[model samples]
Target chain A: MASVVGEEVSNKQVIFKDYFTGFPKESDMYLTTSTIKLKVPEGSNGVLLKNLYLSCDPVMRILMQRVVPKGFSNYTPGSPINGYGVAKVLDSGHPDFKAGDLVWGSARWEEYSLITATEGLRKITHSDVPLSYYTGLLGMPGMTAYAGFHEVCSPKKGEYVFVSAASGAVGQLVGQFAKLLGCYVVGSAGSKEKVDLLKNKFGFDDAFNYKEEHDLDAALKRYFPEGIDIYFENVGGETLDAVLLNMRDHGRIAVCGMISQYNLDQPEGVKNLMCLIYKRIHMTGFTVRDYYHLYPKFLDTVLPYIKEGKIAYVEDIAEGPESGPAALVGLFSGRNIGKQVVVIARE
Target chain B: MASVVGEEVSNKQVIFKDYFTGFPKESDMYLTTSTIKLKVPEGSNGVLLKNLYLSCDPVMRILMQRVVPKGFSNYTPGSPINGYGVAKVLDSGHPDFKAGDLVWGSARWEEYSLITATEGLRKITHSDVPLSYYTGLLGMPGMTAYAGFHEVCSPKKGEYVFVSAASGAVGQLVGQFAKLLGCYVVGSAGSKEKVDLLKNKFGFDDAFNYKEEHDLDAALKRYFPEGIDIYFENVGGETLDAVLLNMRDHGRIAVCGMISQYNLDQPEGVKNLMCLIYKRIHMTGFTVRDYYHLYPKFLDTVLPYIKEGKIAYVEDIAEGPESGPAALVGLFSGRNIGKQVVVIARE
Candidate 1:
């Protein structure tokens, strides 16, 4: 077997075949090998990176489809699909980076990339934990759960918390964090396995498989008779409307994502927003990147809990880059039990 | 006909007509003229009030419709409508209130009302300002705009502010307050007169009549090519959808009311909520009842501005109780230019 080394070498890259119309299929991406000189070009400020592991997020599904007003740049047809990933430095002309250093941040989904190391990249120093942990529990997903719960929800002790998509990367941490804060947490997942994991592994107060429930409103009422105080919203549409009816006075909703509505031609209408007026609820949507400055503080808070076994994390790692297409597509179908991570190589 | 001086006597009162359907027409209400004795019952702990001024708010329109699962009480048929109003104390058994004292808070729309001197009501000490002002500017509407802008929106100097329903009670004050904070303020109103008031009276940097605009998104883009930093939302539906497209990164929206959707069978679905995820925007809905504790602080902040004529106020006062039905109904149709008040009698 040939290995990639310091030479004028060829790097295999994955590129989007064309703009996806609906749900992204495996055929939409094709891997192509190309050669490039290993030396950094003169007067250029870019870093040559050898990609290790790439994070497959549900949001990437929306980025593949056509959305109006062009929110974030969608994957360009016949070009590299960019996302967050971990990489090793190969060659550097940027002032902040050097060769052989490990870094984890936003990068393109390819075997190798020459990136400008803009505001997105951060050098990974501590390897006490698996580097893959940054892709799931300690990176964007972790910060998302942390900031949405602490900053947006502003939860108090003994509050009743409800999480949707409860077994995913962010929802799992949100449930655990709420439990640590002395809250009574209930979560909803798609499958029985995920529901059991919520109750047994993550130590949620209660959990249910939303697929089995005939009426979501009744399910929510059964779980929260007194009504929910904080709702960590990941799935929008009917679930949001049902939760709106079940929210207690002064309830707060931290909207992290709306996975259910992302791929639809038209999103579902919410009929119960008038509840916000009578109940005086606060519904806020936030992105994890806005809270990056709190990364060190988040590590200080979550790491101790992790070491003491007070916090538990789960991941569904796909073995190789060839399976990346399947792993990313599985997110829309709720196939991954926890965080969906694509493993390129074992270090 | 003679005026009854501070004499203790039984008086006729009006009661709410049943829950309304579709648009609330005048016939939905009934002035029953039932008599309530001007005296607190023996061993009772409530105050008997002479209702002077009644506020007609948009929320009352929602209460008149059918109830949902998270339902609240609607006005019973053959009964009077209820809302926040100003009244004079006729008799009192509650220790916190005294006879002949002035008070302002949530009260029923009637000639006489017996209310418990609970936490919702406040004894009015400063009566030098027009007593009717409590029905609009210095009352629940005032506190709503104050808290929604200062607390929720968190405006900073030089930020661009956009207020919908800008000449209505809350939006008018929000635009002025944003301007006073050194923000560049723009407003959308239904009528040209309101647009003029927004720019001239409220000191808004720019104003537009949304009714005249062919496209709401284009109107927003024309007024704010760089995008709005803060949006004080009153009319929801398309306005909210348009504002979402024109929001700058990290914009804040204070959702005080959604008058446009109150009468609709099903509220319009918002398509651009995903913008919040990408732009890191914050949208929060609040009620004045949650922020009444800031009344004294509000008085401190607003009184000086009012005295110095730095803050301008407009009112649409109806002469008698007969006009109350039309005045309240007019809010939905955008007939009233400013605060809508129904005056039963002048003190």
Candidate 2:
């Protein structure tokens, strides 16, 4: 068979079964092979993407739950589940993208995806870094950590910063960013290995394993004796409640995600919110979509740090889409260390 | 004894007996008549106050709690209960306050009090408003409403604003401010009469009795189909949880007080805090102390409104210091309408 611009090709896709109840499992999604034409649809300004690397994020669980968050669409059943990914444009009807152009944005868990929403998609300009970095450090997660830390939290020098889920995709960079900005940073992770990575590798002032602590408030007091000035909230629920108690006066909490609460049929109740008044805390929730305009500035700041080895990122990469479901489900159980990713095709 | 520089005067006081459990009742405090000097002491920069009007606030319950919030001290036993009040400076050893000065600030619930902490004291300027107004509409609660509505909530024209505990001192002003700024204001009170006061007297576009509604979320949905843009949170716990679900994207919640949770041994779990993330909501807890710098500006904005009949104020005046305990305790039971104030003397 000769290669053609508009020829049919085999597309292996992960299909979401349905909106789930308490916790999601690998069985919630199934893989299937389908045929797709290697071209954009007629009269549509869409781009044909051959997805290379897909990100396994905690937010996908929220989109999969019964009620999808505002500003995000639900993953319809019998359709390919989608998230941020690295891809090559095989064909384009949009002016900004063309054949062979490398890009990263919203992509389906399939071999090929025709993305009609072209605005969210951005062409990958710098090739010196690994293309897979677009799925973690240089893409949505990176932007999330950047905007959440610098813009939302409005951190100042020598502030006491605490990051929950500190060894994961966004938290690791937030700790690093706070440290770079002359802040005293502490992090909490589930495993000892991740804790060690946060303290030694990520330059956190101190790190603790949250799983070992029965009293989160006491653990936080041990780490942040003077109380936390900034909290980069990743895993919510009980952690958030404890963080509220330990927050300093006028503390700022940049809420990026709540992985712990995502799987619950009823999200855990947070009781210490009264501290927000006593401490004058500003707890704000935000998404990367609102901060995409800062991408250029983020790249300028982060690319240098990455090149100079000032920033370190770790990826737990699974080989293929067959491993995607387990890898995604494992996030709830703390199975993946650092940023979780699955490669559909490395190219 | 005849009036002299340091003559002793009989001072009737409301003394807090002890920090007791459950709801604050009249028995938690008792009346005691003690002798006090009518003059400020030598070598001390204290002002001798003749407390005329005392404000009964929900925060007094918090100060009486086992864990007093930071920046606030617990009420020591056998001492007169202190809160924001209107007082006359009978004698002063400080230059800022002189003898016969009319002032309003932190005052003890006694006929005479030597206020050593005189920095918080402010000499009443515009006497055109009722002297009793210093305890409610033009005093600390007024400043609280002003700073909270203008600075914290950051409202805009045509925005949908909701005020909880709407018939109370702070909530009433907040609703009026939102309405005066051309915003659609809805209020939730504990009683039907208070609800009527909010809608008819306070100029709220809509009002609801929170106790009457079985489902607060459904109640809010009925009033605000477009969702709340700003929530002036005076009553917390379940009401806050309900408001979280009914908030629009990027909504702001100015947490003025948590009257509902103050007496609870364990605050109710707010399950919908994740709504903060889903809606990109900004929920901030604040005390009037942080915004005291805006008092002069607030006076400039609000004084004329009070004078011109643009802002309506309602007070549930409980006459005499003997009535203080019941008036203050009645706040928890929602027995008092509007601002609950205790008048010690008219002149």
DockQ of each: 0.46, 0.85
| lDDT by candidate, in order shown | 0.84, 0.90
Off by over 4 Å in 1: A1-4, A8-10, A37-46, A65-71, A91-99, A116-119, B1-12, B35-48, B66-73, B90-99, B113-121
Question: Could you estimate the TM-score for every candidate?
Answer: 0.91, 0.97
- lDDT per residue as tens, model 1, B14-98: 4556765577787776565556667788888888878888888888887786674243566665666788888888778899888
TM-score for candidate 2, please give it: 0.97
lDDT of 2 by residue, B1-347 (tens): 12344788788999999887679989999999999888887898998888888999888998886568778898998888889898888888898888778899888888788899998789998888888888888998899999999999989999999999989989999999999999999999999899889988888999999999999999999999999999999999999999999999999999999999988888889999888887899999899998888888988988889889999999999999999999999999999999999998776
Summarize candidate 1's per-residue lDDT along A1-347 as a digit string, tens digits: 22344577766667878765667788888777787666567777888888788898988876787554345778787777778888887888898999877888888877777887545788887778778888878888999999999999999999999999999999999999999999999999999999999999999999999999989999999999999999999999889989998999889999899999877776776777767766778888788867899999998998888889998999999876778888888998999999998877655
- Residue B172 C-alpha lDDT in model 2: 94
Estimate, for each residue in A115-160, the C-alpha lDDT of model 2 and write its tens digit: 9998868899997998889988999999999999999999999999
Q: Predict model 1's lDDT versus the native.
A: 0.84
The candidate maximizing TM-score is 2
Q: Candidate 2 at residue B347, lDDT?
A: 65
